[model samples]
Target: MVYKMSVYYRATMCITLMLLLLNLCEKGYGVNLRDMQVPCEEVYMVKEGETLNSISEKCGDPFIIEENPHINDPDDVFPGLIIKITPFRLYSYKF
Candidate 1:
C-alpha cells in the first residue's frame, strides 16, 4: 500500500509539472522575438518621403549613419538608396 501511494504521488507531481509548463507556454512566457526589440530588416531601401530619422524609428535601428558610412549626408538620403541597418540588440549580441 505504501509503494502504491508513492507511485501515485510521483505521477501526480509529474502531471502537475507538465501542466505548469503547458500553462506557461500557452501564456507566451518565453524567449519570443516578437516580444523583443528586433530589427525589421537588415538591408533597407530608402522610400520616397522617408528620412533617416523616420526609418530609424520604423526599423528600430537608431544608428543608421554609423552602420552605413557611405551615407555622407543624413539629409541627402533619396528614394532607392540602400542602407545597412543593425539593431542595437543584435549589435550588442555580436560582441
Candidate 2:
C-alpha cells in the first residue's frame, strides 16, 4: 500500500511541475524573435552624423569593422560611405 502511494505522489508532483513550466513559457519568459525588427539589407550607406557604433546598434550588425575590410579606420566614417552589414542575430543559433 505504501509503495503504491509513493509512486502516485511522485507522478502527481511531476505533472504539477510540467504544468508550471508550460505556464511560464506561455507568459513570454523566453526570447521572441518575431517581435524584433531586424534589418534585411546586406549593404548600408552611412548617413550624416552616424558613427560605426550607432550604425551597429541601428542595423543590428555588431561586427561592422570585420565585415567591411575597406574601413581603414573606425573613426573615419562619413556620409555616403558604403559598408557591409551582417546582423549578429542571424548567427545567434551557432551559440
Candidate 3:
C-alpha cells in the first residue's frame, strides 16, 4: 500500500542520514566532538632519559607543570608514568 511505501521511504531516509553523519564523524568530525566533552585529556607515557620539562616541551604545553598539580615532584617523574595533560584541541584536529 502507499502507507507502507511511505513508511519504508522514511525509514530509508533516516538510515541514510545516520550513515552520512557517522561517516563524516569517523573521518574527522568525531574527534572534534570528542574533544569537546568533559574529562578528555591526553595520556603521555614518560620515556627513558626524559624529564618532565622535556616531555612538556615536546607536547607543546609549556606550562604543563603548573597545569598538572597531580605530579607531586617534577624531579620524581620516571619512565612508565602517565602524565595527564589538560584537554587540548589543535586547529587541525578540529573538524
RMSD of every prediction: 7.4, 7.1, 6.4
Candidate 3 lDDT: 0.75
Q: Residues 18-51, candidate 2: write the lDDT tens digits.
A: 9997776566666444554556477788999999
The candidates, ranked best first by TM-score, are 1, 2, 3
Q: Which whole-number lDDT from 0 to 100 does residue 71 have in model 1?
A: 91
Query: lDDT tens string, model 1, 1-95?
Result: 99999999999999999999777766666644444565666788899999999999888778888889899889999999999988555332210
Clashes of 2: 0
lDDT of 3 by residue, 1-95 (tens): 99999999999999999999888877886465555543334777788999987876666667768877888899998888887766554443645
> How far off is residue 68 in model 2, in Å?
0.6
Candidates 1 and 2 compared: the better one by TM-score is 1
Q: Report model 1's TM-score to 2 decimal places.
A: 0.61
Give the count of colliding residue pairs in each prediction: 0, 0, 0
Residue clash pairs of candidate 1: none
lDDT of each: 0.81, 0.81, 0.75
